[model samples]
Target: MTKISTTQTQDMHSALTQAIRSEPSLIGGHEKSLKGDAGDGSTVVVSAEEIQLMGIAQPWDWKPDPVGQITMEKFQFCDLEPAKDSGKYFSPGGQSFSSGYRDFLALLSPDFQPQSILSAVKTTNQPPTSGASKSGWLNVLNNAGQLEQKPSYSTSESPEGWIAQVSTQNTEHKLTLEFESGDVSVATSSKEVSVPPDQVYKIQITATAWQRIQIFPGTWYNQAIITIAKARESQYLAGGMAQVAFGPGGLINSRVSEFVVAMMPSAVVTMDEQFASSQQIQASDIQQVKVGGFHFSKGSPESAAKLQPQSVFQSASAGSGKTTISASETHATHPYILAVIIQKFG
Candidate 1:
């Protein structure tokens, strides 16, 4: 990853803001939720708007140019054998027969032993059960006692609280918790309140800035979470989810969530007399330079004067033996003035 300076970050933010303002479709839209398969073989549902914003198009849709590409050579599969019945291939004994199969097998031979085919078959015959039960063979042999058992737990109702509304003003952000009996409003900058007794409140951090505020039931923030900054109004959501506005008058807008309610665990630095030491400057060997008769010391003035001649242009001793010298009287002053002018122009 490339490191970016603070100025670059600010510039990027400004450019992004300008792009969003110029393109309304970038943020304002509603689409059907699409179902897709996750890498883990699990089902995932996401809004079509999100897919569009991610720059992913349909199979036939046009795509932008690629920034870069990675090329790899000498890629091969090991231990793969052609199937007798079909064109497919298989690796026998759960071992790869790839290009480096021998070296790989030798490295693992000491610690890993392949299971026997008969042992694997015997293990597959036994079914996993929760509670004690007679095995099929035992049952066939007229055994009566249970061989396996599974434990069960009782289910009871628990008190719960739901987030009703989340709003923000110029000063602070507020979160309203809805209970069965009444509602409780809490501000981001306010003192921490003990969660209502006997109630299991779900606290979810929906938005870190001004964007869609989701009121889901669950405890998301706790003592483990820390607050870094006060909440404020913004135009973008987490992960760059654009805020959309609707209605004829644009009165209907996306939900406004807190900018930053809490953060995660961080180390705290304690300051004391021992830790609050000041920096000591060591100027034992330093140099002094003269520019246009003006003495500029790199270190202590007293030390610089001891090593160099005192300036004659001292206003305090002008009438005394010391004479006041102007830049016009000194021929070396012209070169210094010219250097300054060149530096400024360059």
Candidate 2:
């Protein structure tokens, strides 16, 4: 029989103790150390190879493969059995796992992979309708080149304001008025005025008034003009004058004067009157004339000579007592004449 030394026996015991501590579950919690000595009076011992054969443990000191040299196999699920359809399974706490089988199948599909990060996205183009598909910054750039047809004349009113529309040969004009307290009246020419070829014109007149009488005249007046040009552009021309007196026999008056000329073939004019009088005693008069194209010069024609080119007048007045009165008046005129020459040969 061979005998082992005390030092060898101690070394073997230390190695066995370390392997047990590293993986206690492998040994199934069995006693690790020996208590009795061999018959030869030396400590009992066991070899490292013998311990491995008993399924106690295996050595883990082997070197790992070099980086990037390892190979991976394609993923597969052939070994996994299909999930059972046992109607439903409930836990002791009343939680249902009826759909657990379907969830497990979904986890194994390609849909479970993480999606790729996106950098940009585009919107889908859609056909335009009267009023639809408006969203985000899309609304700003979508309706760039569209025309809205407006009627020749239309009026729309709201609680806060009113709008009036008028159309001409090549343009449309709109007027909006807002008022707090007062009456509003609008009028337009009833007779149609013919426009020559390649020419356009627009005319608008607006008047407003407010008055309060307390034994004297307390009144306000305003007027404005709006003009639309041939190229769909608008121009405004307005001028007004107002006067008021504050005493018991005071007088208040307002006047507006306008004259326009266009170098065209024919002339057509119309006059419209609008007035509002308070109490009693009021009077107004207006006269206007429109003429076609003509030439004015002396000896050309009696009609042409009658068209006065320049005129001046003066007057003076004096009164005294209850019946004395004196007055003077003066008048002056100037005219231009044009002469033509012609020659004939026999």
User: Alpha carbon lDDT of residue 239, candidate 2?
Assistant: 17
Which stretches of model 2 miss by more than 4 angstroms?
A: 1-252, 264-346
Candidate 2 structure quality by residue, lDDT tens digits, 14-119 = 3223332343332232212222222444431111111211111111111221231111100001001112221111001122111221222222223221211110
* Candidate 1 lDDT tens digits, 190-263: 23222232221211111111111121111211111100000100111122111111111111111111111110
**Which residue pairs does candidate 2 place in steric collision?**
none
lDDT of 1: 0.18
Q: How does each model score on TM-score?
A: 0.12, 0.10
